[model samples]
Target: MVTPTLALLHTSPVHVPVFEGLRDQDHPGFALRHLVHEDLLARARAEGPEAVADDIQELLVRTVAEGAGVVLCTCSTIGAVAEARAAAVGVPLVRVDRPMAAEAVAAGRSVAVVATLESTLGPTRVLVEEEAARAGRPVDVTTVLVEGAWERFEAGDREGHTRLIVDAVDALEGVDSVVLAQASMADAADRATLPVPVVSSPRPGLRAAVLRCAEGVKS
Candidate 1:
């Protein structure tokens, strides 16, 4: 019998280590695979979400065909498209931010979403609101984009990228919790000196993905 694989769909190479570390620490026995589409985000930003929906769907289908028992989309900007594709492909697809969003909404009435990318800001806010609605809780959501951080990340200056995110968290006020919108920003959550909880996507999201895959295997 073949081992089931947990596939990760990533827009940036930075997530490779992040998820690998999570799997090593918490899910050592699970098979892992990565599909990095570096240009997917650029295309989504230039042509809109619908423009790249088909390509994402095709990738998800291929991942499952290649033995992925489940897939996780690490890019918040393309998460909605990934969900639709996951349904069509008949495999469980997890959006990295959903677990964080659900926790953020449950943790506070007022939530702040901080992202380095403009494309992530809207979708993350929408996700938080959706989760709040599902829980029958009312939430006030705010979004912040840390300027120039993504460029620093692109240049491989992770410290600078993290510093900008930490600074953004420092600037937020009256928020019950601050949600870091990307898996790449997870480290910033640890470094933040905020009075409220600072949540990032990677750890909780990976935990959920692993659980889903395990449950699927059992069934």
Candidate 2:
């Protein structure tokens, strides 16, 4: 039987396809379960960020217990909480941006994080700062939120959203390279607007998880 590899997708419905893309890879058998963050996000936005951590912890435990060989959260915004949950779950819980952030820190001294959501940008900035600090490099971090991209994405305008995000990223004045804060934004990395390197989370995390899952199944 194929082991289940649960993917707790973020609040954005847009991430569904991105996770689908990850599963589409020609790896051995695996199953993905998407747990939307919409409700959590709505509550956090309406109420506050205080409650989402508990919600994530609860969801992480539930998903892992459902025979999930490993759990992965697709949102970069909740890295710290996700890390904590992963530790609590006592199973592999891959935070989407951890692998990518590690790569970015190794590549250069200055990093630019391109994200549309304000919530995501904050966590991503912290991750970059922490990574650079550990690397002992003088890091310059810049965050650019793609104006109106998320709204257009929800309206089912993929092309328009892509264009808007690419435009916003292009507008980021300076940096060594840019990291797409969300997996859904990976497509933007292919665009020619970014003269520097573009790092993406989904691919790296997917590859790592897939390899680890395969190892687990073998043992």
Best by TM-score: 1
* TM-score of candidate 2 on Cα atoms, chains taken together: 0.86
The local lDDT score (0 to 100) that residue 55 gets in candidate 1 is: 91
Q: Candidate 2's error at 140, in angstroms?
A: 1.7
List the candidates' TM-scores in order: 0.97, 0.86
- Residues 1-219 of candidate 2 have per-residue lDDT tens digits of 465565654777777767776678744355667777777766655665555888878877777777777777777766667777669768677777877887787777778888877778878888888878877877778778888887887788888878887887777765777888877778787883767778888888777776767777777
Worst 10 residues of 2 by lDDT: 1-10
